[model samples]
Target: MIKHHEPLETAGPTVGAGAPAAGTAEAAPQDESEHGTLQKLKVMQFNIWLGGSEVEGGRAGIADTVATVEPDVVMLSESSPERVTNLLADLAERGLTYFDNKNPDDRAVLSRYPIIEHTSFPSWSKAVFSFGGTEIAAYSGHLEYRYYVTYLPRGYGGGTPPPLETSEYGWKKIPTGPITDADLIMRLNEASGRTKVTQTVLADAAEERSAGRLTLLAGDFNEPSHQDWDHRTQDLFDHHGTNVTWSTTKAIEDAGFCDSYREINPDPVLTPGFTWPSDNPGADISKLTWAPDADERDRIDFVFYYPDERLRLHDSLLVGPSGSIVRSKRVQEPGKDRFWCPTWTWPTDHKVVLSTFHIATR
Candidate 1:
């Protein structure tokens, strides 16, 4: 989802513990391992809204988010070649250095270490980088946003015109009624080409895994996860009493990748991680809501990693506003999930997903 241009919010200095001071580097942990040593690797999945141009002071906020998180790797969605250059410069000014694949697409992968190799596809980008002596194959994706069938169950059109009639058109509130047919929902959702894109990513990750490298995939899938749409949450979050095994995430799970956020917090009811329609004080409600009369908050962005003997998940947290736009209003999430609220301005329309892992170096 994208937001219209709004008056930019002024970014103030953000000083926090854990973040390294300017012109300095964070000291790496000295924990030793049987093979080599264990190094902390933090991965961040963020969709900087339209290259951080949608919200006021969003550009600075994007830089600040990365600086504050101090992630070892970041999979950025909705980013352009220019945005990558700007972000590299921004981070450098903060006394942090980062590396990118230099992909010319809307998605890019940034790493604290130099990228050893890289490749790009129609919908995603991949980079192979070494961290603490281990090679990591990371993929960043920003899938197609059209045919958003999740809105159909909420009584809004999924952007599929003609033949398919809906109670409401586009993101307007014309409550026709909910479409709870599981079959129809999956059919329309598959037409979005997200699954196809995911398949390509899975294939590439498989090759990387075969080579003994750790694999990670993260981005804005523009789709909900099957794990979150089970019976427990069928009636919550305006799901309209239908459960769907959304294809993209299901495919990833089927390929042996674990959703880091969900793995850390298994109970969907207690920790429903909604990433979209993030409550941005800098933007009007019009830009955040797709179905103004219904709860459209969803966990579309994610951080998934293939489990390996060399990799161990430590923690994962949502990073952004604690509140989200539900029924056209900024409502605080009622779940037990905790958010790492940015001391600086929150940059994007989607909440950032940060996952921490300990990778054994060889």
Candidate 2:
């Protein structure tokens, strides 16, 4: 049984979406003559539940998570001042550094390089993004990539975890409109639809003007892809980013962006391999909720790249190499919850995700 250092809070953003917020920083000049120019590197997204019933570090937990990813830049949501502030403080303590949101955890980013600009998109109500870093005229310092970290409202809330009902999953036929009833299913779908549109607008903007610079958006998108998020359940998000599960489950597939993990590891493997069932280490997951089914290990968290993608950001700090898992669990202070499973662990329920990269100009 893998022991955990308990702590949690809101179901925050996915891997890259909720690590740490980044702020403007001074750019460091590069030596063109020495190592020459470099190409743009990888971007990452994740959700750290924060301090809650499931996980419980609050801001302190977020701080420890930041160190784990070791990303060049990061975006996080559902995090608060205590969490963000504590993270910056922790970074400083560990010889690391970061910038924070003056207003709490609306959205933020942390980076290895200096941040040149940070702004929020109009589409995302509680979302913000960062597009700043050392930009050199040449390819080496070329900061041609921009990133967004977001968290949409959960389509289903206040209900006993939902049980899988059918096989349509992501394609659960959209209910006939004029939705006037207060049925839980209808209301949740409506909320999910709104979130879908919002994210689509944001993603479209990035994809529309991606001038050879890849635009990536990451988060615990309350709505999963038509295929993955739904599985045996109903597909609520029919219009998210580019293409969704339809492209995958259909006979004629239209995989919009490459699912990086699949590209690298062809044979799909249950991420986190073990330690998900809220009940047992590997219980009878068939009966759990679709949102977090123990057995169905789908990609709720992800890394997507536009056609403008450059050198891919190497993956694997989060799910370290075989026999070398880098724990994202944080050190606990006194007077905090101690349960480790089903709720209560460092930072948030979702694990802290990390991705690192350096500009490529060679």
Candidate 3:
């Protein structure tokens, strides 16, 4: 699910490695004492599939989606440096100027506003920028893909190598029934290092919030949320009738971050917000699915924000193909959950999460 690429073309000004981008220093300062200034801010969480190289015209599709949505900030996963370069150029041609720190990691932050400061970690990155006098700190992450224990409950291998019965090299079906032990599932999920990495992000985000910055975190977590897996729908989505309090999302919630998508769309049964195994018209079904015989659809991708008096969640929606790969077939999801389908070609096997907020700035 990870890929490397050679640098393509560069478009707008990009910051050098380990340094802040150039635009923020030039931004005019707005007095913090002013009040009643509210601006609509839209943030998008996207995983450009293998840097948008898995399908033809996929990179262009990424640019098109950003241009169409016009999000103020984009937390990008699987964004190779090459893909980021090419995407900036593509967006520039479309008359939209976006800036990236030229992150060397797979996860990167792209912003329509000036990137005042940034820091990058092993699996994630953060960008601090100002929007109408309200400082915002945004963290984007793409967690480890190995030891995806959710698949174990679906009667499939979870990409962890042997020694364990549920461990297998690739996406292979096991001859056993669903593993319904909640503790075992949590242990395997912990081994993936998602919880550890998320804790690091939360610690840093806490500092930012203490400094009075509105904080937003979004990513392709590669794990289900604790909120989604209660007694309500554990039997559905191949949970095998077991309820799991997935540790990663639980940590974020415990740290006082609101799951933005789930906040607006509360009912998991009606608006599941499944983000993975999206039906890509340009790619084959085999490439899209990990478990061929299971309803592996899950709401793994997410957007979380530390609630503040300055921030109000307006709306959030999944942006991608309406149909998803269910049991290895493209099936249209039926419910109140509707996607903001792209007018251009849809890219990636993960649907993008776009959330709108009204940020009050002085």
Candidate 4:
């Protein structure tokens, strides 16, 4: 659905807000590139929830959603080559012929424009996005998202799990059981994997910038950000054990890449932007009947860009549902003031996030 949600956290300027907080790496470039007139690109970042085949509506739903959104470019995760082909074919029927194949296993980049190869970093694929005569380097990356403790089997947390009411307002803490660390060692190891990938991608994005190119990075990061889980939010999600300085996003920010969603919605407390679990209510977790912890969700998917004088945030939307599926769910708590749930017709278990940018050159 095309929503006209309120402009979130309007305390700062819409574009070129100001300098980064002390110690934070500057995400946007300081200078401008004299090239062309104002142009825009609507990019979508989606994780097709298990290869896009494990959803309620299946492949057709995946294609339909893409057609519905009609984003200029898409960065996908938990995806396969076959799924991308299906989506492209579907869009073609609508006279929207998107061409993209720089996908390896689980991540892919599908674009409406011609994609030129970028060889700076051998690990992740980079493409030249020709936007209104301006060439910007777009990096499509799917970082390692599996963390140890998070993936551990249930019993680790002890007793019954907490009541996690999923909605636009995000996870609401309910009185339940103790937040355990039965698999702390394993979870820590899993988190380290994310850290490794974060460092690698940052270095690559930096290389793209040094070459004098505007850069964009989109993907399923699998980890949360240090900014999102700070003092104001720690007490709310206290069940998480400790507020993690998730290295994947931290490295990206330190490397000077602006999180498109976060840039527009500055307050994590207000706009959590939770994407995982999709909380579809139709998800197939029957196999995990014994593992409630297995269903723990958060905002893991993202669309981030290297702030350029040419690229300015226009708007962003978190595509999903608008109510609670879990009954006896709390309604209006602070920070839980609103909820946007996925429609029963929605296919994937993760919400799709779209960010539009206005690129102008003087």
Candidate 5:
């Protein structure tokens, strides 16, 4: 079986005492044999929401994010070549090495360790590749971020979208109807396509399924639940994903992987740490305008940890809170005001997420 589903909930920030050391970088532990082994892996997955418009310059947001929680290995989504290049440059200044982010269409993996190898699995759509790997192939992205030309719209956020959920109680209550939410249904199917890519890679990794080498398939999967598609035409549209709830957790589980958070928390999903809203809340009045800790709802950013339990998972956490969306103040000085156009907030509608994994050869 796909490892009995362990329903889990979002684990809010760890209060003082049990919290991992903030703003500190410790060397990844080593094994007695002197072979490179991961001591601890704090893998984090986050979607910078189309970029990082919620904050000032997504650069600042990215830097601040890394400095805040400080994960050793991070898998970020929705990034572009420009943004990734900028992030790499900025991260380097801070003594952090961003491995294998020099690509297009976002979906990047910024690691503190050296990347061994990198490859991309071009999809049938010809628009986006389903998989990308590096020399190490340990922390590789086996699944594609999906951009089916036949199904996807001409541009990002284009084409027929899912119906805006209108609930009798509120946005909290996932609308249940005879017809599936149009856009949600489409994204859900797109999700399966991504999973197909993931399974194919995992099947290959099965040969070297030995410990130490970890293949993490993570990032924002714009789909929800492996069950519960009771919406307009959910049976027709939601299709195979109809039975699943509004959760990517279920989708990854379907790919023969385990939810990293669930592996630790055992709740149904990430509650307080919903990354979809960019922590600043979105157009959803009920869910938007995140208030430090009050805004508690659902999470769309999912992390699927392939059955690699050897890399000492410790302090494995999702370090994210809302980021600052500071509107640029009009500073009329020597063309410098708009000279350095904040390359972050103007980029997109999501906040950046940072995570680290401490690898040790124990």
Candidate 6:
């Protein structure tokens, strides 16, 4: 069954206070190794809405939510300096310190262990650190979103004209209703092009993998994956005239990365992990300057990795709210391992994906 980590209104005590010192760059104790033979790590992928600046409890809620997970590594998108500062301070107060961060104001990586090496791009960043004497590459990424194509006029935002004007929310002008097949094709092509940046980043990380090392890719792709939206689940999305093959995530998968959430919940029809429109108060896109259609949300955020024989997927935790009903039937079902349902407070519009892995390092 999928593990759902409940949201904490406040930071709790340090998770692994008695475990190995993070200063020594060793892997933390393995909770899954009942036989006490494996080492494990927890990674969290979160897109704190604009750094969770607009949340009711502000960055504190974001910090508290993250602290509750006690992740060894965190990949945050839409992060800001102020929010990161507040989050770090809150974690410190909880006796959980993450000393390393990249691009503290945007796509960033936070690690409790030391970041031995790091790399960056315009839209993504990666850090290579030691875990159980093996090098591990952890990437934080954020891809170009669909607003360029759907919210702005054609050629205005470097995106193609969308097929259907399903939602009149856009720039200065109202969109024409129910687009044509040709328009849909245009949108698909434009969307695919936007993913090239993320593809390159993932490819680079894949190539950098070496012996005694593993690679992890996590963050907000801002677009759904071709794997997630196939012929079977095309109806779930508004369709926008045609089932588009989202390229950003496809590229990562092509490079041999596994979507951590999907790896556990293989049936897309059953476990549709939607992480957008967080459906929160401040997350309403209608209030933005160029309001786009937040009506049809998708699972844009992810935690992906290069699967290794040495690594075992223990459990994936989805942290979000239970309400905010979507129109899809498959997503609304509530049961064990049925999509995601949260009983606690979700601070940001984007829910968090935390994947715990047990690595056999002997």
Query: Whose TM-score is greatest here?
Result: 1
lDDT of each: 0.82, 0.33, 0.81, 0.56, 0.41, 0.61
Model 1 Cα lDDT, one tens digit per residue, 1-362 = 11222222221122132232122133266477676677678889999998779888888889888876678889999899999999999887877789999898999999988999999987899999987678999999999887788887787777765555452366554455777888988987887889998899899899998898999999999999999998999998889898999999999999999999999889898888889989988888998887888888889999999998788898877778888998889888877776766667777889888888878886
TM-score of each: 0.91, 0.51, 0.89, 0.73, 0.59, 0.77
Q: Cα RMSD to native, each candidate?
A: 5.3, 12.5, 8.2, 9.3, 12.5, 6.9
Per-residue lDDT over 1-362 for candidate 4, one digit per residue giving the tens place of the 0 to 100 score: 21221222212122223211111111222334464565556778887776555655656556656665556778877776777777777666645568775565667777777777643232255667665556677766666542323322211321212231111111223234334443442345343466565566677667767877678888776556667756666545332444555566777888788888888778887777666555454554442122343334456678888887777887665666432122223112234212323332556766777787767643
Show where candidate 1 strays beyond 4 Å. Answer: 1-27, 161-168, 173-175
Lowest lDDT sum, 10 consecutive residues, model 3, at 1-10
How big is the positional error of residue 19 in model 6, measured in Å on the Cα after superposition?
19
Which rank order by lDDT, best down to worst? 1, 3, 6, 4, 5, 2
Write one digit per residue (lDDT tens) for candidate 6, span 1-362.
01233333211122222221222236656554433446768788888777656655646666666655667889988886666787787777756678555564478888877888887876788888776665688889877654444322221232333453422343333334433243544455455455667766766776777544788889887666666656667555454434556666776788888888888767666666666655554444343223243234557788988888767777664666533334311133242332233333456777678787887654
Clashing pairs in 1: 8-56, 9-56
**Candidate 5 residues 1-362, lDDT tens each?**
11121112122243332343433234444353233554444555656554565444545556545544455556666666677776777666665655654445566666665554454443210111111121224333423433221111111121222342221222121223222244654544554465565445555545434433555666565444343233432333213223334333454576566655445544332222334333332223332332222222234455655554444434334443333221111111111000111222222333322233434343
Number of the top-ranking candidate, with lDDT as the measure: 1
> lDDT of model 5 at residue 355?
31
User: On a 0 to 100 scale, what is the lDDT of residue 33 in model 1?
Assistant: 68
**How big is the positional error of residue 3 in model 6, measured in Å on the Cα after superposition?**
23
Name the runs in model 5 displaced over 4 angstroms.
1-14, 22-38, 122-192, 207-212, 227-251, 254-256, 269-273, 281-297, 322-362
Query: Which regions of candidate 2 deviate over 4 angstroms?
Result: 1-36, 39-42, 51-59, 100-105, 122-191, 194-212, 226-256, 269-297, 316-345, 356-358
Candidate 4 TM-score to native:
0.73
Residue 202, candidate 2: C-alpha displacement in angstroms:
4.0
TM-score of the candidate numbered 6? 0.77
Model 2 Cα displacement at 222 (Å)?
2.5
lDDT of 2 by residue, 174-222 (tens): 2331111223333343333334444443444354344334344444443
